[model samples]
Target: MTHTLNQPRNSTKSSSFRVDLQGLRALAVLLVMCYHIWFSKVSGGVDIFLMLSAFFLTSSTARRISRGERPPLITGWLHRFSRLIPQAAVVIVSVVVAAWIILPSTRWLELIDQSKASLFYQQNWYLANHQVDYYAFNTSSASPLQHFWSLSVQGQIFILWPVVLAFSVLIWKLFFSRFNFAWVAGAFFSAVFIGSLAFSINITANNQQVAYFHTGARLWEFALGSLLALALPWLSTLPEKIRRIAGWAGMITIVASGAVLDVQGQFPGFMALIPTMAAALIIAAPATRAWANPSGVLSLKPLVKLGDLSYGMYLWHWPMLVFYLEVSGNQKASFLAGTLLIAASIAASWCTTRFVEKPVIAWQNNLAFPHWMPSTGLKAISQIAVVAIGLGIASLSVTAWENNVEHRRALAASQTATDNPGATAPEDWDPAPAALTLPLATELADEWQTPGNPCAGSNNPDDERIMFCEQGGNFDGSPDLVMLGDSHMQHWSAAAAAAMEESGGSWILVFHPGCRYGSDADRDEAECANFQDAAEEYVADLAPKMVLTTASKTVAAPDEYLRSPGEQETIVDHYAEAIQPFLDAGSQVIAMRDTPRYTYSIPECVDSNPSHLEACDGSAHEALAQINPVQEFLAQHDYGQQVVSLDMTGLLCPEGVCKAVIGNVSTYLDDSHLSKTFVLSAKRQFAEAFKKATGWQ
Candidate 1:
């Protein structure tokens, strides 16, 4: 799938041109493109591609080994990557340039990081570490380079598979000379298949988001293909009628799997076998002249031609689709638009394959170096080095450009902050005219605050469910304040920290992304429920002087009216029960009302329509309820002045409107979380609120 149309050269008796397999490559790429553009569902095409890549790789390597020829591991790697990197580098460069011009500045840095990762074949791991959910279909903010994850996995396996085969050969020569190389290879891949499959199933069940890009979870698909390649000779000897049945059945399954199964949610696990095994059946089916042969349709001239362009097509389509969505501002493409995009991708791919892939491959095949360095291996290595240098230069160029943009933006933000008072700006104060928004869009991606220092020793909860971090705090002593709850509360830590530092106090931040501090029934996820339980216990035991958390959550438009008293009572009860432990421990609770949530990225919206800043402004009523649930909870409970609700909605959304930028500062990092710069701008307000709630000096 990564290097389609470049079947490895096989010198064995069983080695022959696999026209049918080439056509399968075409089908796989088409399925992937169509699914992404029209369906927004997984087609299991990527699984097929993984299997096919391993099948071809194992087939070529096994033949050489069985014939008593040493697998040309080093030369093979050099030649393979030399051919692959040039076209990939061209695409990466194109994407970086196009993304800069087309996508919002907010996405530019991430695109740069992903482009570099793609060049080095580490994109899968990068996505995995970032916890990107590939199944979450959001075309608006989808990365143009997301398709590279599969290519990265394939590229990684390309390096690992050869070494595995070489090791198998060395082992055979040393001890198991009596057994055939195929048997030894089969045993090794079988172990890989079982172990990886079990791991995939377990991880996908627990965290499909990470499992989707996990290399180990996907290795079993490659092993299944390797197993099929080893067993191909025996399979070819089956009766023609049986082979035909298996081949047709497999083809049908390949086409139908996406429609019939939950491929996106349950892939590279046991469910992935539907497509991988289907591809195997077709590969093992007898090649025949009969019209009934599945190969007849698969080996068609047009399909074979598409297979030749498949590698380039896979590289081209995603960025085109992403760019189209960005320019059109369409969530999904219409039929005609999708067709045009596909056609444009095909044209671009044709040009890349013709002008880029073919030339580099031919050059590699006929490469020559100075006579002083006459070794063929050295020549191969030189070709690889040339491609690597070119790719490195391109990546570094993008990095340098991004760094420059970031620096300029940082300077602009600093200058703007003096004039742009943000939330602290007076109701009638006129903001100074500025060229750039404070906390510029380029810097907005990193606006979500992270705890600067992790809680350690007795301060640390030692619980995986909750992330505990201490700031402006003496670790040896009990925290002066504890900040608890989800990211909604986490964003205000900047203000909390500033307030704490000013008062010569310390605070511990206890929160998990998307996890609200509430009753078990109120939490949807098991991890979040556990986090709530752990956080409650930790806060009670520590008994900090004050605990801060969001008391209410906002609902985004169109049904975003303020909740009624009855509705507020239920939410108030939930918070009262959750924070009762803190009250009993003589700790004051500061329950700030949650800030507004938006349906779309405020920064991106503002970036797109800088002139129409008012359009990005949201109704305050829609953002928050008129009645503060925490205030109601305080009135209901007999905790005296120990529990107090802080409402800063007036400061956040002045005059019943939540502006994207207040006095030049961007209001939010994305849609839900407030920018740290904006929060810090409201430092005076938070300090006053803290003094009122906790009676702190």
Candidate 2:
């Protein structure tokens, strides 16, 4: 037992401890880098590392706490955080700077927004809400910081662990002070591991990628290591045979997890148990056992070297892989090239750790603060200072880019020849009178709810409408039921007609791309408002009972061009003001929420990997369980605006997560918008919900 403590790392000829563990790190990192680059698989290397991290940190922590020598939680957190934040900041700030310089104007503003979220460690949520699809690859715009989702999840674990450990030690001291510490830690690991497994399995099935990224469900892996550390005596006593096999077995599990798993395969589910348990076994295996000796394999020098660079390796690899894909256009590549990239990543990571992470980490540790200051307080101030500096730099770069970078690049008019016309997609089409996506049909339902645009005045009343015909007659058949709304209703046209026909009735549906019902753009647009005033007078005369609509969750939707603070606020307030007409009219507002949108579309998914479900996006129900800002907003509308849902709560989400697709069918036509086929399949489900809500069969 004392041998491990006695084994000081030599500059040359690394010990069993160093070689073996570092070797494990190398394997884990290699797997991850390869999977992300060429294998195109869900690499569980990060998961394995996370498990290892929990074990190592927890084990070390228990020893300190047990000796009644515990340091301040905040101090420890900042110490670890310091090791991480600087490099992360560099990557993030660098990405933002590079993006500002390299990306086109249409994406510049969005990149800036993503940078803000990345800095705050909310990239996972940013990606999940904006990019997750059950059957699709996350082909969203490259944010080097997207990899920080793991960092955020880990940071969350770090933030809460110390407090919990302190409490656990206290409780144990009071009741079973002399009782085996290992057992209590074991209990912690077992309970948490089980919970995580349960959660991972359940949520992966349902499509809640964000929740899966939540720290609560992932804490157990780290806790398992803590438990192992507390009970090191039990491990030290184990025979060589078991220890050797376990160590090797753990390595195999991590490799398998990284190389084989896909998006549909539940992670952190039963599948995660393999990597987590393997990690547990590695931590629990003693230095010199007979049968499954950790000494012979894990304690190698090259492995030890990699372990020293492990932190930087983890940070650097993902971004590099992404950058490679970005540069190469995520193409089909050779295994040999992938191997080289992984090697290059390892080399680059090592360099980064040595030059960047190590110096800052060492400096932070060596810094001498005022005698009166608490260590935690000094560390907190330093971290804030670091963050402030990064933010300042990023802000300055963005401002410079905004000034230097050209906007609109000599507009379409300038590009056109005398005979040719510069045009936008859907230029010839007019918005359906009651379509949701069309600006005129549904005045941006919630001004604060959308993104990209802030002014809610872009709808064209004179545009021709593109119809999907949800519940309507065939081309030769007479139009009976006319359904109208944005993409949500348009996608329903094909299915709605089928449902009506199945019911011995028919419908004629008209679809508008962005128009929503019972909403008006009149107040915000001078010309449109006048047009709307006259139209409202007429529409007041022609109300349609069978109405379909949508409200988006993009935050500041409907608002457009949003140039200044006054404009942003005015546009938001103005859109909020637009909801008055729907309340005033006795119009049945079936304000269907906008389907969840992924960061990218299917074409990219197909281009990236033709074989995987990444090519097939989900069912309408799978796309989401709940509505966007519309549902919540409708609850507070002036009048009792009767709003009915597609009953998407449980059916749309299972185990607390919603998917974009299930089985093989495509759920959305664009982003999170569903296709008519999906809407048709959902008829029975939506109908049941609708009937229950309105009591009309």
Candidate 3:
């Protein structure tokens, strides 16, 4: 089913009437490569490629349906899929091996899980969640299949378009042969297209990065392409001069989408119309122009050549760039350097297409045995089912090859010592006095929730206090410390209880899981909106000595979330007014900065690369740059001799970059928060910083 794209179908073909669009494919790929290699500051190339994909697919299918021919959708799916899988397999296997050497054991396990899902084409949703912070010019890390969100959209179209198209064909067959079902299909698709675009526009107006990677937000762009194809009959008959003008207009739109738009702009939303229309015009252009030939500007030698290998190049480029950036510590891409990398990617793709993709497909094609009959076109896909199963089994068998008693023992031992929660219990610094301990950790019991820290607090007041129990004993054993914050601060109590154990601090960790440190009257994200008044009253009654917390700085400044400066100041002051309790209590306050976010899921971080060791060697500067703006809020605070900083700057950083990885392992469990492995690595550094800032020593 995997046809040779370079070698056009010779067995049975449509006459050489016109394929002016052949040149357009070359043009689209060129735009994409240029944007990726040098001007990711712009996404014109991506827009062009997206438009072209919809145009070509819908047009090709219309031709078949127009003739009353029904080719099985599975054939095209398998063929297109086979064309890309081999190279993907190699990249994944390489990433897995690299991770084992360079990344921490926790990240390694996650990568394996993401790899299996990606292998089956489920990376789009995985990446959608990632796009929340994925395209921030300052965001670090990238998914190997981040681009595949486009493919998933296309694949979904492939399945759904047929049902819609087939139904339209039936209407044409039964109602009237001369029926223009194109208009009907166009109208229906256009409705969904407009509706989704409206939704995307509303959402993206608030957050463009999330809109960029979300499928629900983007489906309309592809629908625009399909609608364009359905309009081809009218377009092909337009005056030659008008067609040329439309082509020019389409080109201009694509360039504008990339060059004129900023990350803050609502994109592939209402702005998507610019490029989508442009691609359709370019594709539907007349063949009369000399520039429209495969050998001309549209299909110049370089573009046509590269376009042939575009599928492979797109598949492998991001992962390679990530690995390169990780090991070399290069964040910005130079024009010449990026071009060279793109060329290298092209070469690698060509080799993969020739040796791996072709041979495996041929083997499957030629497969025939006495037990099976070839009743299907060209080759029976069912006949090759057994071989596919065998290959799957082989892949899994290789993955499980090291399953042995000793290896199991080593894995188990590693998981317990390095991975188990209790192994890295906070060093109790009990020499300190009771009044000095933090608000959250002073009260101790056995309910501490960070998995392994043995000491925790008793949630039940009636039950005897379990204070300072994890580190052996509470030397002075009174309960007067009050810890106030989110779940993160709650987890740090083990260390706090230890610090206050001698004359045990009267500590109680009053935390709401998603609860932020910011005051009510603001809606950054409520831990539980209904509990606002009740919780604040509860805290006031407790009247703890101090308040320790961590949350988004935006919680205290909602206007900062938008472009209006005057609004930011007014809103921030109102927000701060909501949490004036601590100043009244005469309590010392400590505020931890929220952690930086990663672009990919924790698992995708591992699956995207082949070598974990190389991926693990990234810098904190590159990873944490987005949060530099956060310093602005920190500087504006009015609290005196309070508001201590628990910085991860040095702990998460190495050299000049701040990567998601730390000490040969990814540090984050999700977008921004630290994973247990990463948190422990930073604990020693955090303790020292805390002591220096608060005089807790």
Candidate 4:
């Protein structure tokens, strides 16, 4: 199961091949499978895979080069990729088909992007750059291809490691032929290990989500394995009893690493050394070690067979689990479902290894297909051609499908706007069972005027106002409405725009992603602190007829709606402080309560639970304060007569339960933000409320 290049005809052979390594591969795959399916944990198994891959590749290549054989660079690359790509290609194709059939169309676009990333071996980069919360399955749906990140990392390393090996080969052949080549390789790998490990620690501490998928952050694990590969000969010289104890202890450490340590949250930082080092220790043990060695357990016939299927299983398991969750509407699978999924993954892995991988590897070895004349020393051109055509067709088809969906949604939105200028739906209308679609997934994106707005990221406190304005009605210049705060405030942009159009006013938007309107440092984002200060000054300067913002902010803690006592008080006090300046400037201030957040996406819930929409509904008491903190603060001590409070919770949580959908429209785009499609329907009601609160009409 350890993926490695084909040894050239003249390469040095091992005393005997290690079947124990194969067993370790099987155990690692099983650990990952179990952790993902049942434990909802990370077993650090992927670290073991990374280490073993590097160990095998480095040790094999080093021994050949040290023995003065030419590094079979061309044949090696072909063998390595051919062994991997064929099986990976099959799995990617199968996953695409399964996703198209089983997953909601809303997720198809993301799946398409992920499929391409996986196929091209850039999935880790894709996930890292996108800031995907790989661990937060409750709030964000797990991507079927998320597990491909490790495979992608390995693929990247496979390509890059060879270059380093080839460089080492050059040095050994050109200058270090008289010296021990192992030391040269060891020094190089040691440098890589130290450098990458330091970076991993720094980046993981700064941004764990990105660090989790960053290839740079994980390079040290592979480097450590390479270092171990250089020392394998010396390691084999250790006493038999010591080797046995090391192997057993290493295996035990790896098994316990997941259960006893916070591996997922802290890796691939220094903590990752636990599993990777353990794997290296096991690999360094001599194959002839006694039964006291853990290799005895690992090299059993059944485990060896499982190891043969490990690569395929690792590729196949996650998508199956994700598809099962999507189809079954379960956030987490039951024991029965998990068992069935594991069985399915194993069966698929066996078929893929037997029918797909073995044949491809054989064909590649035999050179049955002709190579392109120009791209000499590479695998048969036919393999690359087939993969490219397959991936290109799939990517374009999905892109076209997404474009068509977007075109239809845009047409629908335009028609809806024309037909209902006020954007109101019927009172008794309910969400259609099949209403959820791909367009609705990012429906809120168009609701904000921030994209082309001049006000975006305006941090200057003295700009003489009127930078980014979302004008709702024809204005000679005077502003009648202003929207301020973070995304929570921006969520109501559509409704506020509609209200402005109806009430005859120009509205200004001033917001950043995590910025609050108030100047309190504790409650606001440090990065956006200056922007908030500028926004406060700008709002006071404009003194629009009415200022609209939100009192809602997500607490820093998980599953906790109520902020810490100090944060809550600071937020409440800041709200008054924020509005006091606006009130003094004769602008009526209206602070709306934030909508309840849910643990899942509305569309995902609707897709999975078509017959039970109520399953998506959440308790207000759990997701929100019993009473609005702003409303309570205002009631206990009046901020000012000019400051008005609006509770539009009735629009969101009409029956004391925040419904996923209302009036045939999906209520939320994701976990907490209201979908623009749903918000559009409430424009008329919002306009009326605005008129009542501000007496603007």
User: What are the per-model numbers of colliding residue pairs?
Assistant: 0, 75, 43, 3
Give me the runs in candidate 4 sitting further than 4 Å from their true place.
1-16, 66-68, 334-336, 365-422, 425-439, 442-444, 448-452, 456-478, 501-504, 512-538, 551-578, 591-600, 605-667, 677-685
Candidate number achieving the greatest lDDT relative to the actual structure = 1
Estimate candidate 3's alpha-carbon lDDT, on a 0 to 1 scale: 0.52
Q: Give per-residue CA lDDT, model 3, range 1-697, as digits (tens).
A: 2222221222124453233344455455556556665655546455555555565566776777767787446666555555445556665665556555454343433345456556665555666564534454322444443555655555555556556666666666687667676766676678868888888898788767767766667767767777877887787798877787777776667656666766346576777767667777776776553774322355454655565666667666666665555555567567767777777777777887678666765675666655554446435464245335533643563365334323544543444232332213243422212111110111112233443233344422221211212222332332344555555555555445444443345455555565544545434554344344444454455454455555333222124355332122211223344356755655555555544344444433543452542463343443343443324555777665655555445555545544544333444454444554445444555656666755664
lDDT of 4 by residue, 603-634 (tens): 77776666787898876655666667766766
Better candidate number, 3 or 4, judged by lDDT: 4
TM-score to native of every candidate shown: 0.85, 0.58, 0.66, 0.81
For 514-612, candidate 1 gives per-residue lDDT tens digits of: 877774545778787888888899899999888998877665554345553223222532777888899899898887777777888888888877788
| Superposed Cα deviation of residue 299, candidate 4 (Å) | 1.2
- RMSD in order of candidates: 4.5, 17.7, 10.5, 5.5
Error of 2 at 282 (Å): 2.7
Q: Distance (Å) between predicted and true CA of 38, model 4?
A: 2.6
Cα-lDDT of candidate 2: 0.52
lDDT of 1: 0.80
Deviation in angstroms for 405 in model 1?
3.7
Better of 1 and 3 by TM-score: 1
Model 4 reaches what TM-score against the true structure? Answer: 0.81
Q: What is the lDDT of residue 34 in candidate 3?
A: 64
Considering only N, C-alpha and C atoms within 3 Å, which residue pairs clash in candidate 1?
none
What value does the lDDT take at residue 21 in candidate 3?
44
